[model samples]
Target: MVMENEEVSFADTVFGFWEDSQVHSVNSSNSSNDEEENYDDEEETFCTKEKNKAFWEEQGQLLQATLCRTSSIETKVRHATKEALGELNASERRCICGQLEVAKAKSCCRNCLDRDIRDRLLSLGFNCYISKSKWNNSPGTPSGEHTYLEVIDTSNSKRGEVKVVIELSFRAEFEMARANEEYNQLIMKLPEVFVGKGERLRVLVKILCSAAKKCMKEKNIHLAPWRKQKYMLAKWLGTYDRSTMETLPRAYTNRPQKPKTSMLTYDLLEKIPGLHCTTAVEVV
Candidate 1:
C-alpha cells in the first residue's frame, strides 16, 4: 500500500510539471510571434516613408534640370513670348465675338490674345505657327482639341528643323483637384509659360505624371486617364496640324496719327468719300 501511494504522488507531480511546461511554451511562442509582427510593421512604415521622400526629391531634380536647359532659339522665343504676354495683358483687348460677355467669361478673350501673340511672333521673324492637336477617344484619354504656339528653327541645318513648342497655360495643364502638397509643389515648379524643345517637354510630362500617380496612390485616389503620361504628352508632342496663315505686313502695325485735315484712327474719310469728319475737332 505504501508503494501504491508513492506511485500516485509521483504521477501527479509529473503531470503538474508537464502542464506548467506547456503553458510556458505557449507564452514563449506568443512572444516570438508578437515581436516578429511588430518588426514587420516598423520595417514597412520606414520603407514607405523613404520611398515617398525619394520620389519627391527625384521629381525636384528632374524639374530643375529640364527648366535650366535652354538653347539660343528657345531663349529668343521665350523672350519674345514674355514680351508679347506682358504687352498683351497690359492692353487686354476685350473679345469682340458676337457674345462678348460669354466669350470673356469662358476663355477670358483668349482668341484675340492668341491671335495677337501669334502675329507678334510672326513679326519677330520666327517660323511661328498656330498648331492644333486633336485626338480621338480610344482606350486612352478622351477625344479633345488643344491649340498652342510652335516655332520651327531651321538654323541648325545639320540637325534639321527643331520644333520648340509653347504653352501659355503650361502650369494649369497638370493641376489637380485635392492633390497632395508634394504633387502641388512639383506642379508649381513648372513655368506659367513653357517654351522648350520637344524632348525637354516630353521628359517633364513623364516626371509630372509619375509624381501625380504617387500622390494619388498615397491618398487612395484613382488617377485619371487624362493625367497619364501618354495623354499629357499628346497635347504637344503628338500628331497635329499647323495653321500657317499669312501675317499682316509689319508696316501696317505702325500707323501714323492723322494729318491736320486727315483721319486719326481709320482711313474711313480717305477711303469712303461719303464719310466726313466733324467741322470742329473735339478732343474727348
Candidate 2:
C-alpha cells in the first residue's frame, strides 16, 4: 500500500511539470503576437498621417497658384482700364445721341449693349461672337430662345477650351425670369448638343437693370458666388462689371458637367425586342 501511494505521488509531480511548461509556452506566444499587432498598428498610423500631409500640401500649392494668377489678372485689368479711359472722350461717357439721362432711365439699344459687352470680353482675352447662330434653338422651335454671345477662353491652352452661352436681359423682372427659363432649357439640351464631343457648356445670365437697387429689392433675388450647377445669374449696372468679368472664367474652367440621363419613352422600350409590357400605362 505504501509503494502504491509513492508511485501515485510521483505520477502527479510529472503531470504538474508538463502542465506548467505548456502554460509557459502559450504565454510566451501570446506576448509575441501582442507586440506584432502593436507594431503593425503604429506602422499603419504613420502611413495614414504621411498620406494626409501630402494631400494637404498639394491643395495648398494649388491655392497659391490660383492666388498668383488672380493677382496678375488684376494688374492687367488695371493697366487696360487706364489705357481705355485715356482714349474715351467726355461725351463718350454719356450717351452718344445726347440722351444720356434717357438712356440711363431706359436701357440702351440691344446692338449697342451687345457691342460694348463684346469689346469688354475681348479685352479680357475672351473670343466673343455676337448674336451667334451656334446657340440658336432648333428652327421653328421657339422665337425667344437665343443666346446673346458665345464666349471662349483664348488665353490658357493648358486649361483646355471653355464654351459659354451668355444671355442678356435689359428689363428688370421680365429679364430675370426669362434668363432662368433659358438656363434651364439650355441645361436640358446641352447633353444632346455635345454628345461625344467632350466639350463642357456653361450658361451666364447677365441682367442690366436701370434701377439696380429697386429691381433687386422688388425681385428679392441675390446673386450667389457659386452654385453646384454650371450656370450663374449676375446683375450688372451697365454693359459689364469688372468683378463679374474677373469671376466668370471660374464658372466653366475645370467645371465638370452634370450626369446625363435619358427620358424613357414607349418607343425607346420598343427598340428592345422580346420585351413585353403587362400594363397599358408604362412605369419607368
Candidate 3:
C-alpha cells in the first residue's frame, strides 16, 4: 500500500511541473510580439515625416519660378516704352509717337493679334493695313504708349500725285475717325487722276509700337503699343479736368488743297469764311 501511495505522489509532482513550464513559455512569446509591434509603428511615423518634407519642397520651387518670370517681364516692358519716345519726328508729319495708360492689358496672344486688328478695322469700314515690320521680340521694358507712321492717299486726282504723311499719337475714337476720314478721302480722290495713266502707286503701312504681355494658355500675347496709347489718350481726354489738366496752344493747319493752304486755329474758326476746321462725325 505504501509503495502505491509513493507512486501516486510522484505522478502528481510531474504533472504540476509540466503545467508551470507551459505558462512561462506563453508569457515569453507575448513579450516578443509586443516589441515587434512597437518597431513597426516607429518605421511608419518616420516615412510619413519624410513624405511631408518632400511635398513642401516641390511647392516652394514652383512659387519661386513664377515670381522670377513676372519680374523679368515688367523690366522688359519699361525699356520698350522709353525707346518708342525717341523715334518720333519733330515735324509731326513723318512720325507719330505718344503714350497713354491703357484700360486693361490685351486679351489675345501674338498669333491672334493680326486677325483681331483686321477684324476690328473691317468692322469700321476701313481696310486693315498689314504692318511692314514683323513682331518685335527684343527684351525691353515699355514705360509709355505706342508710335506709328503712315503714308496715306487722300485724293484720286493724280493717281499718286497727292499723298499725305499722317502721324497720329493716340487711338482715341475721335482720333481714329478723323484719321480714317482723312485717309479715305485721299483714296477716293485717287480714281480722278486716271490710274494707269503714268506713275506707279504704292501704299505704305507700318506699325511702330510695342507692348509686352505674358504668353499663357488662357491669355494671348499679340499686343500693339500704338493701340494701347490710343486707348489711353481717349480715356484721358474724356476725364480731363481743366483745373488739373494742362493744355498747349496748338497751331492747326488747314486740310491741304493744291491751290490753297492756310494755318488756322480753333479761335479763328468764326472769322474764317471757307476755312472753318469743323466737320460732323461721319461714319464711312
Candidate 4:
C-alpha cells in the first residue's frame, strides 16, 4: 500500500512540474516575440534609409553622365528653346485658337502654350513638329495619348537627321505626391524644361521610372499604370504620328482702332419712331 501511495505522489509531482514549466514557457515566448518584432522594425527602418541614400546617389551619377554626352545640335536646340520661352514670358500675347494665357509655361491653358512654343521654334529656323503618341489599353497599362515637341536637325550631310525632344513640364511630370525627401531632392535636379536628344531622354525616362517604383515600394502603395517604365517609354519612344501644326493660325495682335463718330443718336433717331423722343443739344 505504501509503494502505491508513493507512486501516486510521484506522478502528481511530475504533473505539477509540467504545468508550472508550461506557464513560464508561454511568458518567455511572448517576451521573445516582442523583442523580435522590435528588432525587425528597426532593421526595416535602417534598410529603407540606406536604400534611399543609395538610390539618390546612383541617380545623380546617372543624370550627370547622361547630360554630359550632348552634341552640338542638341546644345543649339536647347539654347533656342530657352530663348523661345524667355520671349513668351516677356510677351503679352494670347494664343488665338485657345484664347488662353501664354505668358507662362505653367498656364492653365496648356494647349495654347504648347502651340505658341512650337510656332516660335519654327520661326527660329528649327524644323519643329508636334508628335502625338497613342497606345491602347493593354494588360498592364491603360489607353493614353501624349503630345510633345520635337526639333529635327538635318543640317549635317553625313550624320543625317537628328531628333531632339523638348518637354516644358519635364520636372513636374515626374513629381510624386507621396515621395520621400531623397526622391524629391533628386527630382529637383531635373530641369523645369527638358531639351535633349532622343537617347538622352530615353535614359532619363528609365532613371525616373526606377525611382518611382522604389518610392511606391517603400511607401507600400501600388504604382499607377501610367507611371510604369514601359508606359513612360511608350510615350516618347513608341510609334508616333507627327504633325507640324501648320494649319493653326498665328496669334492675333491687338492693333489700335481708328477714332470714329458716335452713330448711336442717328441709329436711335431712325429706328425708334415716336416711342423714343430724344432732345438733341448742339455743342458750340
Which candidate number would show the highest TM-score if scored against the true structure?
A: 1
**Full-model lDDT for every candidate:** 0.82, 0.40, 0.32, 0.82
TM-score of 1: 0.80
Q: Give candidate 4's total backbone clashes.
A: 0
79-175 in candidate 4: lDDT tens per residue?
A: 9888877877765565566556343444526666777778888888999888888988899988888888898899888979888999888898889
Model 1 residue 156 CA deviation (Å) reads 2.2
Tens-place lDDT per residue, model 3, 212-257, is 1111111334454443433333222212211112122221222343
lDDT tens readout by residue for model 1, 1-284: 45644555777889999999999999999999999999999999999999899989999998998899899989999999999877655552444443343222224455555666788888899988889898888796877778888999998789998999989889999999889999998898889889999998988998899999999999999999988987888889888999867443222122353556534666786679998687897889
* Tens-digit lDDT string for candidate 2 (1-284): 55644555777889999999999999999999999999999999999768745644544444334323323333443344334334432113323333332232125444444455556667767565564232122332321223355454446688676444344441222223423332333233222111010121111122112122223443466532222121222211112312223222211122354866566534655677777767788779
Worst 10 residues of 3 by lDDT: 196-205
By lDDT, highest first, what's the ranking? 1, 4, 2, 3
Better of 2 and 4 by lDDT: 4
| lDDT against true structure, model 1 | 0.82
Q: Per-prediction TM-score, please?
A: 0.80, 0.30, 0.25, 0.73
lDDT at 260 for candidate 1?
62
Taking the candidates one at a time, how many backbone clashes does each contain? 0, 0, 31, 0
